[model samples]
Target: MVTVNIGTLHNVLDHVYGAFMHRTKISPLFFSGGWGGSKLELLERMIKQLFPEVVGQNCPPTLVKPVWNTVWETKTACLREGVFRTPCDEQLLSALPPECHNARVAFLTPKFVPPQRMACVVHLAGTGDHTFERRLRLGGPLLKENIATMVLESPFYGQRRPMMQFGSKLLCVSDLLLLGRATIEEARGLLHWLDSEEGFGKTGVCGLSMGGVHAAMVGSLHPTPVATLPFLSPHSAVVAFCEGILQHATAWEALREDLAAQKAAMTLEEVRERMRNVLSLTDVTRFPIPKNPDAVIFVAATDDGYIPKHSVMELQKAWPGSEVRWVTGGHVSSFLLHNGEFRRAIVDGLNRLEWKESPS
Candidate 1:
């Protein structure tokens, strides 16, 4: 068997093409990366390969808006629209922020639309790389020389700068109180925006690492996304994260140790009672796991210390009857190993006619 590539050959493309053509409703694919460092380039590369016109249509910084905004808009358009712009406008391009220059977007024309019906797939990148501007400029071969120059260096002047901190307060508010509720709200806003703007009714979500957890939570909460692929995440898994695997890691190791010590002092019941309000992201089994119109899970189990099989299985049980696609490596490693297959499953699942037959 050709284990290297899960969805290979022209046949895969043909299947995808068929899926899009059959349906009247448009379902563009969305890719979410976990913790900012997710392998987004790989996903983009595959998309470009499948859609040759994508790169050919790549617009230079002009036609879009401020270059940075252009990149952001373009990327959004690519995910929601299904077309990229080439021969971009100069004035419009110069106005765009640097971060927006390289982001991509696409649209579905009569020519580009496929035969089989498709569902929207949104890939969410996780919480690393704290700087969105930096993430924007990091891609493409040209950035090799100017990577460091693009950094938005900080100079704290005790007081606040209203515009500079535009989203800062909202973020803090969401983090401090919402307990993942804000993320769910944001995801809903995004889905509705896409539906209204792009004419796509149904949406599906896929995320890795942090993005995975975000996707899973939103998938479980919303009905708009009939299908969801939480590539490597479980929201409530943090209890396990803090108690078990976090010991050896550097970033969250201290917090984990503190939790362990605290747990030793308190009764398990007391601990659960106190933390239950905050750590509800994981216990999908406890809460009702909303079945995606069709829900599918992909986990990288081999060397994945961060996300254990037990966690995945536990989440799986919560989402009983859902389909789980297990791979051989660690967290995102399996994505690299079986990216093609994963991609196919996504496209195939989205293209599928009946929701009853989803992944399970």
Candidate 2:
């Protein structure tokens, strides 16, 4: 008889989940359409030309306006959502709907605190409709600790979601890339705003799933000292879309049918390679490590079908000295399996930060 350790079993199950559950469904349009063909090539070329080296380059500044009419007070804190216009020109905005042009947003500050010398965490919500209940549950612990938590509505999500659009619908591959750029820009603005505030102390960024990926991107680009914690996010967008469970929700089957009608012959592997450069724009490894590696903590799922273990490992390796906490079970289940542990990690990470006053 052979005895397999729990860790080994978990690893085996993770591979099983990856192999059986999240198999890729290739779409030829992913390599031929506007997002894939010359348009994508142009975008990649622009990135290379404009940002020969992404490191040390400053993110474009943005202005955020609070929706005064949308202000509300909670028992523990005040909730106010805002919207910020993306700086991208009309050409880029054409890819996204008008509603997304003005990104919806929000931030929470402790009710009674003066907000002076207090830590702030910018919490990015995962994909899908942004429910109020979900935000409260995720940010509850941080708010209790008197750490102001800011929430940025991801593009095509929440109030920015196009009218009558279903929660799981993603119109095209380009839409995802546009959303990625928008989220990163808005988050950068929010962080800058927090840093500029007189009462702001230490600032950190965090998110779950897609939000986690956005958090990592903002953490990498922002030069300011801050902590980053990405929960259950894949390190590579290319891998996540091409090989993860969420691939099904992306309408790949429809795209595949369309390609079949056009008699296009392309495999999943070929599609993945074609989208590599465009997707690399959001790759965690391509960005710089946070100012403090110790301040960066990753919470990953051992048996996550949506985010494979290799993706998390890639991010961990890229950010040397960063911490990673692995919880058992698949992506969605792991959140429930390790809720307490995840909360503690977040609280501990925020607490570990040495708060300091902003410069005059």
Task: Give me candidate 2's TM-score against the actual structure.
Answer: 0.81
Q: Looking at model 1, how many pairs of residues clash?
A: 61
Model 1, C-alpha of 67: deviation from truth (Å): 14
Clash pairs of candidate 2? none
lDDT of 2 by residue, 275-306 (tens): 56557766778777777778889999876767
- Please give the TM-score that candidate 1 achieves against the real structure: 0.49
Tell me how candidate 2 scores on lDDT.
Answer: 0.68
Model 1, 1-360: lDDT tens digits are: 646543233224433443443222332111101111112222223223212233245221122221222222232122112112222235323422233223232221122322122235555544332333322322222112111111111111011112232221211111212223323334444444444544443455655565566567656655444456666565454533343332122123222333465355544444344334434434445444654434555454444545566777777766776667766565435534555545555554454324322322
Q: By summed lDDT, which 10 consecutive residues of candidate 2 come out lowest?
A: 25-34
Q: What is the lDDT of residue 305 in candidate 2?
A: 65
Best by lDDT: 2
